[model samples]
Target: MKKIAQFFLKPTVPVVTINGQITEKSVIELEKNLKDIRVSTAKALAVVVNSPGGSPTQSKKMVDLIHNFAHDNHLTVYTFAEDLAASAGFQVLISGDKVFADQQSTLGSIGSITNFMNVKELILNQGIEIRSVTTNPASVTNQSMFKDVPEELRHVYENMLQSQHKKFIDLVEEQRGSKIKVPKEKRGSLLYNGDVFNGKQALEYGLIDSIGRVQDVMKEEFPKADVVFPQKPSISGKFMEYAKLYNLFQTIYQK
Candidate 1:
């Protein structure tokens, strides 16, 4: 009876959560979790994402890490977004072989930006004198609040942002491939304009594969397998709770 029951038991699908901001610290924690999951007996992996996005470089690192994990373990990867997945979050979402999101889930925002505030006037008004002893004053002042950004420096920053934006677009094109319904030329204006969308709009724009809740979709897609979270849910739970509190306060303040 024991042998028979054992033989009937199905493999488990391990899940990883990517909630809140994606930073170097968060990616490091993920690396540790993946290292543990690498030795697991599961044949498939799932990622639950709910993030407004952060740190483009770290986001790419996350995508690469997950993709390598799938390759190394020969595991099928499924990604689901519950509330939000924008910008860097969307980058990580593309790592999945199949992506799912709730009907109300927010997705996309394929663009790049860098902001620096100039406080030269403020400091001057405060009667503070600032000096740069460096050989190249531009180097010290380019991004410093103590000095104004030169036109050439502003141009340089613009070019850098454009370059990053192009790379982001290219990544989406490469990953989604034929699944993306948007024409190549029109993608820039339509999909890469830093705008977000709901699941239905995402599907129409070819940003996601489907609109469905995580648990329901998991049951349907992997009926014989039990969904297992490889890491503790406390971290993600805390993040979501904090996010809710912040939003609540914002609403109250606005009202």
Candidate 2:
């Protein structure tokens, strides 16, 4: 009788959190949780994102995976922004079946960026002499801390940045169905400048559907249904774990 009753009941939405940098490890963890939910219950999945964005490749991969999972399982995927979801975070939001941003939550800055450091002055200031032997001339010639950056590396990075920027534009165009004219100058490497916009402005910019809360979405989409948050680690704990991993990796590589 109990087993028969289970057949008629739908499972609860599986909730996953994205609080920090979306790296390979983070994506894997999310995929695992989604898989568990798929196995345990035949229900929809909800992902809560509060991120400043990170690792474009990782973001794209995660979004692709989530989209595929929803298609395969015939499940609806919803995303709710708690505080902020910028840059690559926007990609994940677009992948959702329905996306909701908190009324005061921030979103947008749909772009990409890479950081580079110039350390020549610091080394010279310390009176440190460096010598290198490399099989390739370009390898040694391309590496510099004080001198002008090699044009080749600059072009390579620029090209990569432009490609990512185009990808972001494409995603937004596909999801929002609005034509946003991004000026040539604004489409450069500084596209992902970690900017935040309120929900009202986000809607104006066509970055999100409407200005509303997560509960509002649940009420509209799953009325008369129970909303559930799966058992999972808190966002703070996840961030701490990531910090530890980053520190360990830094220590090993620095040594």
Candidate 3:
């Protein structure tokens, strides 16, 4: 009698969580999981994303990598939003072969942003005088946040933002397969101002396809396939669990 060949199978859908700031590590882990799925006995892939977006560079890299992987493997990639998916998160969604959002899930606000806080007032309140000398006159103004911002740097920043804004619009147009209409006045950096929309509203605005749960879609598409979660114990969850245990230990010691 011939020996039977044992076949191992893997889940097609891998839910990746992007709760906090997106980092290089998050990108690496996502790539690793996708690679594993490619070699495994899985026909397709799905990523359940819940993110507020992060570094623009990292977000772009992640989106490109996912797009390439799906194309090479001929795998259908689906992205299902949970709770929230905005900014860089939206970028990743565009890479999906099919994008979905729940009835209550929030999406949209496709844009880029950078934030900086001025500490000059705090130092001045402390009676601290800070002085700096620069070889270039422009450098002096650039180095200090206390003084009014220089027009040149402001123009440069605005230009960079405008370019990014255009790229975002282009991506949306490509993914949606239609031109999105936005007023000329609202076309700049104000594109993503942390606005959240329900599924119906999102569809009206051409932000997403349909309003349905992930499980329902899976059952309809892959009736016989099993769902899988690639990475376990999200960073935030692990941290909270550890904190709870530590608190328990402290209470016991005090008693």
Of models 1 and 3, which has the larger lDDT? 1
Best by lDDT: 1
lDDT, candidate 1, 1-255, per-residue tens: 323322433566778889899999979978888876523446678888899899999998898888898888787889988899998999888779998888889899888877887899899999999875656544524368778787777888888899999988888888896899889889878898988889999898788898877677778877887777775447786577457656766887899
TM-score pick, better of 2 and 3:
3
Sort by lDDT, best first: what order? Answer: 1, 2, 3
Instruction: Report, for every candidate in turn, its global Cα lDDT versus the true structure.
Output: 0.81, 0.69, 0.67
What's the residue-level lDDT of 85 in candidate 3? 81
The residue pairs in collision within model 2 are 120-145
lDDT of 2: 0.69
Clashing pairs in 1: none
lDDT of 1: 0.81
TM-score of 1: 0.82
| Clash number for candidate 3 | 0
TM-score against native, each model: 0.82, 0.74, 0.74
Candidate 3 global lDDT? 0.67
Residue-level lDDT tens digits of model 3 in 1-255: 011101323235544545555679879877777665522435566777788888778888888877787677667888878888877787777567788888788777676666545688888899988776666645424546665556766666678787887787777767774533455456444344546677677766666766766778877787766666664457796587557656766887899
How far off is residue 57 in model 3, in Å? Answer: 1.5
